[model samples]
Target: MTLFRHFRLLPRLVVAIVLLVMGVQPLAAQQPLTRDTSFTVASALRKARKDNPTITLAQPAFPSTIQAQRNLTYCTVGGRPLQLDIFYPKAKRSRGYPAVLLIHGGGWSSGDRSHHAPMAQQLAAKGYVTVTVEYRLSPEARYPAAVTDLKAAVRWLRTQAGTYPIDTTRIAVWGFSAGGQMSALLGTTNGDAQLEGSACQTSRSSHVQAIIDVDGTLAFIHPESGEGDDSRGLSAATRWFGASKTDQPALWHQAGALNHVTAQTPPILFLNSSVDRMHAGRDDMIKKLDAFGIYHETHVFPKAPHTFPLFNPWFDLTLEHTVAFLAKVFPKRP
Candidate 1:
């Protein structure tokens, strides 16, 4: 039998797979968590500095090697113009390059697209057209608004398909935390009109060929989920869902990526941290993926922080895994 057949029984099996394939550290060695821990580059860096004070936050160079078009308005919703940044290689390709939409995660309320600038620049330098986009957060809008805004971004990409150095058919979404959940949903629900909101009025499709979900919860109602815990003084999920799980159970389930997965869903890559709660419904989703014979890969960095993708060592590894998976899913043209 395949090692993945017993996904429920072997949640840590992913760690072993990654360790053997990538030579990453063992799962037993994890960082210690604190009481008042937060999930942000700035907040995590403070704790990471304890280990390596010299470690600095990743920043984009003023005159980067790659070409960058920053702050281009992609969509206008409710008088608020949503913006996006595009990064492309200096040498334009006649056939265009694969594009990746990088999404930032801050419980769906706090982060901006700028958090992914460094990552977009690096991917551009490595021959991919990358985009970082802004969406209406929970404080600004609610539930489907963020999803609608993201789909609008995809449509915007289609509008600029031939104009920019991007291959519209080979686009993908890579997101972290809350953005991760959105990414998975985007991948699974390709062309679902309900999520394709009025943020943009384009006939283009929001179909992503691939998805990379980093530490995003797939199911909010699952036993593994840590969302909607009012004991912590208004959890992130509750705020974004607009009510308690008991108050609006259907909405909570509607937002879950696990419920949306289908045989037609595109390939997916799950990059995760040590936090079990973050891996909510991941194994189950993989079961569905496996049953459908859909392509998927899951890599777990045991004992790593929830926001490891923003911090070094982990960030570098994340990029390595990302590039490798993208190459396998969408091979470069000869």
Candidate 2:
């Protein structure tokens, strides 16, 4: 009996020693988070910069020979001046070129135009005048505030077309996550008076030539309301709309992009990751698009997580697919 007890104690002591060794081990000995495959955007940017030093945060200097400028304009939302960043491309002819406006996503509480500078620069490099604009976030400005700013940016872009190399008729809007939802709103609810009354009302057309929505939510109604699908928890909607799921079901529905789709909506490219939670809303939006017989494409990637735009392996693939989609949807004039 004593010998058996000693044997059991010996195994326990060995296990304790192993735990101690692991606890004292240097962090360097542990496997690093896969640099190129990190799901976080910051990590991806770090890896991207490591791989290509030229992908810096700074925007490229305007080419002196091409004739270009960087301008900021203030659009009022509930008596506050929200600023926008415009990158005008230089053109040889007097005719304006197509323009693409980008909206950044931060769950409607954070994020700014600077967050999307790299993508805007890429678009500018592709021969399109690009504008990345900032909008008011929640707890300060609520629903329709961000949407209003986006429409104002469009109107402002059109008004400044002569000064900038922008073709008002060929304008397009691109966004990620929350921003994507806003872009979908702009594309589908062009005539909605409540949301478009301010800056968008006077514009000849609030309609965009095309829309690029990246893994954005389209419905406010919880997908799991009835079946205990806790996946549709009210966290995101509550944050953005400032109301509990049970408190304002009607308002939530009204704010949903899927609720606003119509036959006249512009062509769209819906890009999402297979593992993303918002893919359901994206699917709903696609269904609406299908019901309307609207031209659109859906590109879903396997194993890519939500907000994959901020990472590398997936981001690289996203860029390739986006470029191809853009070419297909908005081909350059011959």
Candidate 3:
């Protein structure tokens, strides 16, 4: 009996020995959170160009060593630690770098920070300090909860400006699908107290210098338009808002990004599919932007679908426009 028991321990010992011999590092250690400080943008861009020639839509403009710090806790909501992944250039500079808060899309219910990590990586490689954040999802928290989380994340990033090579003053927000709606709101509601959530780091401004909305709904109250589209049933918006338009008409209107647009709103870039129904109030919003003399641009991919931003060819095109816009809005530091 004693011999058999000792042999049982042998199996565990063998496994431990195999792990030791293989030099298996801890999960966190294996995937380092901090970037290697010595890398630079120029070298990284050069490598990216050489390795990914096909992916290049334009000349590789910004060359920087991109470093990603994953799963950094930004806020605590409902006892859950809301996290964000920060991707920044490793190149050392006197001044901090411009940043973009990249939000993922899943109809405000299913997406997480890592959903858009590839895009974030691309942006980072181009010298922008990009952050992909996780917000409180619907079925977990409702309407303003995600918005509030995003606001808090903006402030949190500002707070960490000193730690990472981030320029707090030149932050932008970019979102896809449901994320687009959130980003639009952030741009339109710069100083609105009512939309701000009860999260920590509220002292800092949640305002962004620019906004990029990719196929996201601007006005949920507007009837769906465009061909092959019958008036549909309850949308993700209705579910997220927790009520139908008829039940909460005021809320629906209030949630529309167009309703909040003003002179103070920042420059916006809209990238959308030709046949997407979510672009209900885009024309009207552009009119307001024109009236206010606010800088705004739009790109329509005639053949691409609603989720084109997530795929290739279109993604490269998206990045080309995005990089151009970022350069114009927040120029590279000397």
Candidate 4:
């Protein structure tokens, strides 16, 4: 019996020896994995800033140091496919790079993910993996729908971390206008089940480590907010809620980013125009942020418009502030 057992095991041992000699990895040694490289956005941005200390009036005309992977379908809503574009740094990082989810502003009505592609590329070139996303718009879908879609995108990004050179722990969101509102909500509403829509990758957390709001409203109830009805048929906010402010005041309050702030809320950076009425409740929200001992910063560009981040001079300044803020909040790994 012992001799018979030895003969049966002989073939397996011989095969293992042959594989080792031939340098063939056995099935158990193979893994579904992505190769990591030692490259980072922080190091690249630092070098870029040092090489060119002057801020330019327009996007640099030179070849981009990033690679753009366009139109990746991340989720679907109402049978419509939602897509996101990813910008990858040319330099490889072994530990992976911090990520930013860029949401466009179109009053929750218009605008597409492509709107922020240039900015995404710019950030990617500096060593970050940046993505621009598309969400359900108002009139077609009401309040929380867009937020849900955005959250789903976050989950999708997290799920793909293993396949991409991304640091799942250091994801952030940046938005403009309506997109800023969504970004603020994403930052403050982390771990809240109510806002996590029934989108794909539902098991993952949608929480972000940092948020950058460019002229996005923090409080809709504030008198200065332009979202409420102004003797018009219905305010944009009311339309978004699918009910008038008088009918859904609770929903209005729930949608306000200020309502969700707590010590657990991620650090935020507000970039606004000196005179933009959209940021009416900023002071009050800032007070809350301070009370909660959260780190926050505000930069008001004098004489700039609400869409200043889209233009030069202001864009350069915005980028400067953003780079500094992100560096402090999500430092690169060695």
Please give each candidate's TM-score: 0.85, 0.74, 0.78, 0.81
List candidate 2 stretches off by more than 4 Å: 1-71, 199-204, 222-234
Q: For all the candidates, what are their Cα RMSDs to the real structure?
A: 19.6, 15.5, 10.1, 15.8
Q: Which clashing pairs does model 3 show?
A: 40-65, 41-63, 41-64, 41-65, 42-63
Clashing residue pairs for model 1: none
Q: What's the true lDDT of residue 94 in model 2? A: 60
lDDT of 4 by residue, 138-194 (tens): 757889999999999999989987777889899999998889988999999999989
Q: Candidate 3, residues 1-334: lDDT per residue as tens digits?
A: 7643664667766655555678864343454233222222233334445534443222333344787788899999767798999988888766888889999877776656665677788888887889999887776777888998999999998899779988888999999877998899998999889888877897888889999998887887776633112258646666678887677878878778989999999999999976567677888899999999999899998766566666556778888889899898888766
| TM-score ranking of the models | 1, 4, 3, 2
How big is the positional error of residue 82 in model 2, measured in Å on the Cα after superposition?
Answer: 1.5
lDDT of 3 at 79: 74
Best by lDDT: 1
Give the least accurate 10-residue stretch of model 3, judged by summed lDDT. 32-41
Candidate 1 residue-wise lDDT, 56-103, digit = tens: 676646335688888999999877798999989878688899999999
Candidate-wise lDDT, in order: 0.85, 0.68, 0.79, 0.81
TM-score comparison, 1 vs 2, better candidate: 1
Point out the higher-scoring one by lDDT: 1 or 3. Answer: 1
Worst 10 residues of 4 by lDDT: 35-44
Q: Model 2 compared with the native: what TM-score? A: 0.74
RMSD of 3: 10.1
